[model samples]
Target: MSRLIYMGFKLLEPYEGKLSRTVLRGESGSNPADLPDKAIASPLMANYILYLYKTMRKFWGEPIVVTQELGDILGNAVIKDSILASSDTICLLDQSKFRGNYEQVAKLLALNEVEQRKIFTINGLDNKAGRGKFKEVYIKRGNIGEVYGVEVSLFQYLTFTTEKPEKTAVESYVARFGSYSAGLEAFVSDLRSSRLGLADFIMQVNAE
Candidate 1:
């Protein structure tokens, strides 16, 4: 039996549903702020969730937890009266096995530099027992990219910068003419628009 306490914006109606269901997956629980370390946890890094919740409260009403009937799960947690939502993030608390797997998945996702930089940053990294976690955003991608079978020499020679906040390094790639997008439609458009081969495309981007 594992438990998770997550924070998400109430302003986004779609996300409220998604976040609530996600947190209730097992013998889980939630807290408005941070929960104790006995359980694994990850939080969002930005306050964007707070801004959305406050701005959209009138139309969507206050964000809330949906009732899911389960034994000893969904423990009592307070709904804070304050406007500043803590972390505006998602936290997962679960059994050791699930926690390990979850952290690995988070790491894998974070490896996708564009998505990682856009959504979350690697605040803390550890492989220790009973205390591994990563913070991320609640924002869902409005678009997804597809591989284009194109490659170019100049595109292959661009070197990626190794600088502070490496996650945003993809932005530099974009500045050098790399096209990355979340919208599938836009992605398809860009892919079709390109004339480079797949290997050459990666090489060009990597060189940048």
Candidate 2:
């Protein structure tokens, strides 16, 4: 998906679709670290990418690059020289998995010790006593960055959750209420009134 943007963005430029955002998500599966190297080494790709951002910016477009393979991306020429330079805001999930090579990430992103600490502290704070199961994200803009906890409502989480049992619980509500949206509304309302934890409420639904 990410690599195709260099090839496809120009094709869409003439039509001028009303797309406000462009997302380039890297392949997160097991693969060689040099995969992006192969993608960016093409002179054709480099030339296409040079003009890609101009067209996107013309329509107030924001390009977001999502990659779990930071090792591959940081080492790749296109990301280091092109994408990173154009990107002003960077949102990072937990970097614990990359602690061994975090120095490269810091150097590439120009993060100092304090900002680096914020990246490491993603989901590390001991503040989840009452909050729902959530994750923390580190968003850095220019220089300073802060870690923010991300909590979602039962409806929101359940709507997108891929777990079969959990999805079945949500679907049961959708079945009873006639529509997914209204079912989500009713599900949240019932969960709120019951005062049960989300898992417990799901268990109750499963039991029924």
Candidate 3:
């Protein structure tokens, strides 16, 4: 029984813009300025992933699997090399890698509607050409347990603020539409109260 934890968190804006271009880009790095605006924007996401990776390392003392989102942006060879240099593993989190027998369990326990929608979009299930492709491509590729693993865990770190004047985009969006959309605050409140129970549930599911 290998130890596995699946963790994820929403992207947050960094304080003070503390991550420098050189630090993020690494030595002998390409000038992000030369890249397209979209390419340049990805470094911030990559930096955040790195931050999470380091933070997780402190707790688990092990290498971990990460989503393709992280892998796509952290294209710098030096930084990637540094990550791989560690004794633990850092493999791509893909459907193909999932273990058998945990598929239904994952669908029932791991994903909510929002997450399912996101997965649908990621795998092009919503696209005309790719309609109904999610089951064929995504789910068939791996069970949730295989993708997240026992060592994998998700963390959603949101900086919520009621200060209307200083609200971030996400906060504003939630506030404006939360009542109609999905009771975002209520969900968070429930999550806070039931997190321990959720963890236990996951452990029990994995155990079986």
User: 1-208 in candidate 3: lDDT tens per residue?
Assistant: 1111111112122321222423343323221111122331244444544564464455443324233333332444433544434424322223333334334424433444444443434333334341211222323222231122122111222233343332342344356565523444543454456654433433432343
TM-score of predicted model 3? 0.23
**Top-scoring candidate (lDDT):** 2
lDDT of 2 by residue, 52-131 (tens): 55555454555455566765466567666876778878889888888887787888888998888778888887988888
All predictions: root-mean-square deviation over Cα?
A: 17.1, 7.4, 17.9
Error of 3 at 91 (Å): 4.2
Sliding window of 10 residues with minimal summed lDDT for model 2? 26-35
lDDT of 1: 0.33
* Top of the candidates by TM-score: 2
> Candidates' lDDT values, in order?
0.33, 0.69, 0.35
Give the better candidate number (2 or 3) by lDDT. 2
* Residues 1-208, model 1: lDDT tens digits: 2333232222334654544454434323332322233221122312334443453443433343222221112221222223322323322222233333344334422325454333332233243233312222233223332221222332222222243333233454445454543332332234346765534433454465
Quantify how close model 2 is to the true structure by its C-alpha RMSD in Å: 7.4
